[model samples]
Target: MDYKSYPVVENIFGISGLNANLANILMITVCSAIVLLIGVLSARAIQMKPTGMQNVFEWLIDFVKGIINNTMDWKTGERFLGLGLTIFLYILIANLSKLPFVITTEPGHVVWWKAPTDDPLITLTLAAIIIVLTHFYGIKIKGFGGYGKDYFKPVPFLFPLKVIEEFANTLTLGMRLFGNIYAKGILMALLVSLGVSGFFGFFAAALPTIAWQAFSLFIGAIQAFIFLMLTMVYMAHKVADDH
Candidate 1:
């Protein structure tokens, strides 16, 4: 089995989980805990005019809030602000982790705890969560009847098509993030196989890899934004009508 093709799963309290991939619930749990702890501690990093980590998180919160406001009505978008911000930071850090030094030579060729986004399962799971959230909120805002009527869309006769589109959109959302991030891993694997410095690798080989890493970071953020936007869009659509 190509280690690359298979999840880096490790047994954890009975369940086999991803070893190097973020699919490992344990790893994600740890990461999430760290983020939460930091967020809690830094909630008031700066009282007057925040500095350091507090400043960064505040700016991030403001940034996510702005995105929500611009893309969705204030009333509708407020609910998703935390999710959007969490997704952005979780994914941003995950992607950026790839740019740093990696340990490599681990059980599953692990390195630098590579960004969670680099793992498709993680992205797909997140996509599923987003879809679920959209539906949950959709049903919450609109009654069960309204949620069901959403499938019929513009007209009752369009039920089948509407259902297909809704299903397709959710799958596509996951696939979009998965495909790009997974591709990054593939590229990195190829480069590492060449036994050279990475673009950011202190060694000379890093020259080329750095450019790719930068591009990956850009892609990561864009994907995160798109995912959040789609979440809001889906929610808005669901709540907008009862067919």
Candidate 2:
């Protein structure tokens, strides 16, 4: 991949040499719009007896509720239902976006479209946001003093380790998603290149491409669920008194 071929805006917002990846930005916008559309269409009309999208939407709600229940009390987790649902849906869509096809420009072979989650910057930003929100809720649910005290619970010697753990959590959470999606992208690209090499190469690549694509769908869903579950788990640790 020619990394330099990416459509980037340098010196963004007048900051010297700050850069923004247009491809990632575009993919994020597209994924968010799809999620929003799903929300609107699914909930457009309430029925005396739910069917179709309503059923799917309600099922998703229950799924997220179960996740929250597993991590923390429903009373505490109920307020986060929307947050959890949105995250789950958005990540799910983003992960699956590039499975069907990848678009690239000629000559430089610049990627015009792909899963946003495959990008480290996007994944790390999401992880950072979640971590920040966990801290926010921790302070809101427990007083600042209470939350702060948990960092030193049982002993004061572990404070530095706990601090380091927060950073570790952020890195692992982000890189886990990025690594999986990015690897899948790389494998798919290699398969495509092989198919285009010659007739014999095409036959050799076809079966593996199909198999990988099928497996990738399952991998995408699992990754999304893992991300959601971990988010709640982290949140539980931050807000729960027993943690």
Candidate 3:
């Protein structure tokens, strides 16, 4: 479906002078809250014999930890793990929130909340934060000179290109995430509007939408991993003075 045409949940506040973007912010805040609640509750209720939810949550944490450990030195990884873990959880939930079943009612209101990550501003803001934090961590770990040396690697003449690359890379990372999730929403809208028989809609349309949602879920997970993984790798290379 044409993404430009999807009904966006707009200015829900109905306030005369409120920030229009407030709708998006509110959505993100809510999603963050949910992720936080789930994470804390999962952590607080310890279990010798794990339930399925606990197992799944723990498995995800371990998976993220493994990424950190594999991509970075123990000292740096330990320092960033708390922040990185939070990034993964927030992005995952934000992307997954785009899938169907996030229903809403009331005239002039579409979904009160779209996926937080679907917004360009939000995604890029996150990308900016990740990049800034990575650089900050690099400076903290290896002093300012080490971080500076990374840009002029192999040849001092390469500094300008490297600087451009850094900005472009983060920009791509943010936009890639926003594009994929937003496209999925448009695709599901297409499935729902294909003008097929009700049974065909259920079996043919709904079925694939389910599969796509599941696939999108996987995509969301991978994107989150890739974003944080790159951050770690960027820092690793920065701190590795020889590079």
19-74 in candidate 1: lDDT tens per residue?
34333454476567766876787784567778888887888888888877766677
| Reference-based TM-score of each model | 0.77, 0.92, 0.83
The candidate that wins on TM-score is 2
| Model 3 stretches astray by more than 4 angstroms | 1-9, 12-18, 47-55, 101-111, 195-204
Once model 2 is optimally superposed onto the true structure by TM-score, how far is the C-alpha of residue 167 displaced, in angstroms? 0.4
Q: Per-prediction count of colliding residue pairs?
A: 10, 0, 0
Go through the candidates in order and give the C-alpha RMSD of each one to the true structure: 4.8, 3.2, 3.6
Question: What tens-digit string does per-residue lDDT give for candidate 2 at 96-205?
Answer: 99754567666556566889998898999999999999999999999899999988978999999999999999999999999999899888877877887789988999
Give the candidates in order of TM-score, highest first.
2, 3, 1
TM-score of 3: 0.83
Candidate 3 local lDDT, 47-163, one digit each (tens): 999776688787877887887778765665777777777888888888887756444445544556578887888888888887787678778877888778777778999999988
State each model's CA lDDT, in order: 0.67, 0.88, 0.74
Error of 3 at 123 (Å): 0.7
Better of 2 and 3 by lDDT: 2
Residue pairs in clash, model 2:
none
Q: What overall lDDT, based on C-alpha atoms, would model 1 receive against the true structure?
A: 0.67
Q: Judged by TM-score relative to the true structure, which candidate is superior, 1 or 3?
A: 3
